[model samples]
Target: MSTSKLFDSYKLGPITLSNRTVMAPLTRNRAVAGFVPNPLSVEYYAQRASAGLLITEASQISQQGQGYQDTPGIYTQEQVAGWKKVTDAVHAKGGHIFIQLWHVGRISHSSLQPNGGKPVAPSAIAAKGKTYVNNGFADVSEPRALELSEIPGLIEDYRVAAKNAIAAGFDGVEIHAANGYLLEQFARDSTNKRTDEYGGSIENRARLILEVTKAVVKEIGAERTGIRISPVTPANDCGPDSDPKKLFDYIVDGLSAEKLVYLHVVEGATGGPRDVAPFDYAELRKRFKGTYIGNNGYDLALANKALAADEADLIAFGKPFIANPDLVARLKAGAELNKPDQATFYGGGVKGYTDYPTLAEVKQAAE
Candidate 1:
């Protein structure tokens, strides 16, 4: 396949991207004692600044929003200052970045939660996965259903986090609502069984996400707000939605009213087969007029095909970015890519994180 299409420029919100490729958010538990993006993360991101856009790993909006160990948060002043260095470094290298605001909901342990309170979700069910905490993997604990009174505060958390993101010098913010996290817990019918306004029907199940989006948009202008959603992703122990196409179509149509900069959708299961469900990508793409990012299992050929057919405005690569900091240039030059070392993916030093040699560096070594 010709690599011309992936190299084409496109407009995203107020900034003009050099290309349509995006570095998908990756969860590397590399943070300071205060859960701030450290100097290592700064270098890690700056190295891959050539991508059209870089999304930071899912950052907890508040302490209560965290689900894993050492993941950064956006609420504190120290965290903002730490992230500022990262954004500044990316900007210095002529790259744009957006912080992904996140909340893991029930997929958390008591040690990760504040005041030793049980993790909060739309319902009090335990997910079927273990979260790596401190230095070991622990089973996810059963959660406490969120109180009605706490809903307002939850929205406020996103509002404050959005403001903090702009303060940290990010060009924009992407609301993390996918992959069976907090927002997805409320979005999917199987996870959410509440009878209140925030549960039950699709509209009710979608209320929390819409409210969070509205709050974030209010804090940072609509043009700078983007959201991610997975219609049928069973990741993080999520169950299948009875009617994925109808459910996600309603979600896409509802999100359009917010005038978000983009809607990022994971076409199928995360990190699994691309055809895990029967939903139509074109249908979901048509529901939203704004830019659509198609993520989950994409290579150079698929990325070009999607853009050439107008199926997606952008493509996000996760594992590939881990070892290929010069992915964009490599694709353009048709060069070989280095394999990623998964053992060093989380809570590690510069080895697999930022030590991956560029194509030029590799060729020079060969000579």
Candidate 2:
């Protein structure tokens, strides 16, 4: 019944985390106008500050990176200021925070894009699904392929965002290369149909992510930057990777060369359309020598098993962290957890976000 591994302190770059349970970035779409993190976000994050680490939800690096309404941005002065509050709150609670940098790429609709411009991707192909817009989920629009000249600018955007994150008092930043986002659009072959330097070959396709990570590391220290990848996930409009294992190996090797703080891998398809890709996660865990955070539909038992088997150095929990702010304590004490209310997951008030009962509350109820 020991949970020492989960409770042990670990070093991520220059910072040391008190535990190995990380709060995974989750989209709540609760920001204020102009995509600023609201006070509610402050309270929400502050409430969950007991975790070893907390990664803010996917935040756009620029206006064009936005896709959904109300999701926060990291590009503007106002947004940075807003995020500063959340970082301050987490820090005051002795918790480490990392902002997740994101760009929706072709998954966005014109309504969501700034200046009504076309959503840009590696190819001009449109995603096969709907995008959440002002009204609701609407059919996705065709995206314009980014010219080779545009790639460097996009990488620079990430660099600036990483710098902004550090300015906002965050310990580091996690590049959102997962869940069919911009970086994933480039990593997967189906969305990247270009014959240019950024397409066709695996190294060519992974160029943007590698360059972006390196640039961010240059802006901040490599020890303070991490990248999240979902090699098996097909969320949004991304399709099956032609050779996931090879593509990811090239990516992991390139990232390992940077000596990043950690690599967050979404191990399986949680609810994404695609079935989980056939590959050995143990191979990935070995390939990436740095700290490994395994995510996607993991329960307490499964997470412990992964740790015991040396399959992962850390465990990132999404929904569980949402419903149980004191998730680490619950696991340590073997307490039953509160179930998450899906309806209040996104764009809602504090009921589902902050009202979840902790172990103390459940024990009080029993009394």
Candidate 3:
């Protein structure tokens, strides 16, 4: 009978979360044919239903949105059907889930693009990295700057994906504007070199994300729409924003105007050091008037401290959720967490996906 704010119920928009702990989205690259969720995904997510909320791995909103091999998509009926099972399973265990809508933009290879075309981006710059495609890693293809005329269609894609998510049984949808992905590429100056309306100023760079957020919010009420943003994360060769504080403050202000249900912020570098930059996370927290989910390298002690200080309304755990399906129980009891097998992290079947045993199982095994 442990009691902590982290384990308390929370009301997020229209749905109520069992606890404040969220399972952050982690790409497993295990989608089957047609970029549909693998059958095992149903089991994988269902096992971690104890978390207050679960955000599934990034699923592309369109074929052109994909940047990796075997990632799931939500632009088709089959894909929606695949996800229906996943959502049903989570709900069956009295849990809530949200699907992250993604568009990789330039962080993609030609093979992963439709008709072997170049990936699209805010600028025609090639990211200094590789993307998983054709069953292996390859230099990302140089991208073509998205035409202004194409902007409307991209925004529409997000709206439709949000609609499909609700149809697929998701409690809500998270707009993947974080990482170095499509939306982030448009926001960061290092990657976006366009002089068009979508580039040049912090407000301009933040336009696409804001428009997409509004579109999603319109399609599915503000409470059902949340957005993720990483202000200073240098992931996906986004380099550094010339003024992260100014840029993200503007972004958060717009997101707040949209009246989104939550704002999931990656505090520092994604999966890296939390003190990688000097930006003030509290600034963004103050700007946004919604549930602020603090992510990146959060252990139990840090989570407690952040919650106690009111730095974040909820805390998101990434790797910890991968190895500990019963993460809520483990954290409550101050029990040791299972170490995730790095080898089976990506493109795996079942060994590391759903095989992690809970503390109860471990105790039973010893007995």
Each model's TM-score?
0.98, 0.96, 0.99
**lDDT per model, in order?**
0.91, 0.88, 0.94
C-alpha RMSD of each candidate structure in angstroms: 1.0, 1.6, 0.9
What's model 2's overall lDDT? 0.88
Error of 1 at 310 (Å): 0.9
Give candidate 1's TM-score: 0.98
Task: Please identify which of the two predictions, 1 or 3, would achieve the higher lDDT against the true structure.
Answer: 3
lDDT of 3 by residue, 1-367 (tens): 4577888889998888888999999999999999999999999999999999999999999999999999999999999999999999999999999999999999998888889999999999988998887777889999999999999999999999999999999999999998899999999999999898999999899999999998998898999999999998989888999988888888999999989999999998999999998989998889999999999999988988999899999999999999999999999999999999998888979999999999999999999
- Measured by lDDT, the strongest candidate is 3
lDDT of 2 by residue, 1-367 (tens): 4556888888887888999999999999889987999888888999899888899999999988988878999998899999999999999999999999999998888887878999999899888898767847788778999998888889989999999999999999999999998999998898888898899999899999999999999999998899999888868857889899899999999999999889998877854322466777788788887999988877787888888899899899899988998888888888788889998887867889878988898889999
How well does model 3 score by local distance difference test? 0.94
Which sections of candidate 2 miss by over 4 Å? 271-275, 365-367
Worst 10 residues of 1 by lDDT: 1-10
How much lDDT does candidate 1 score?
0.91
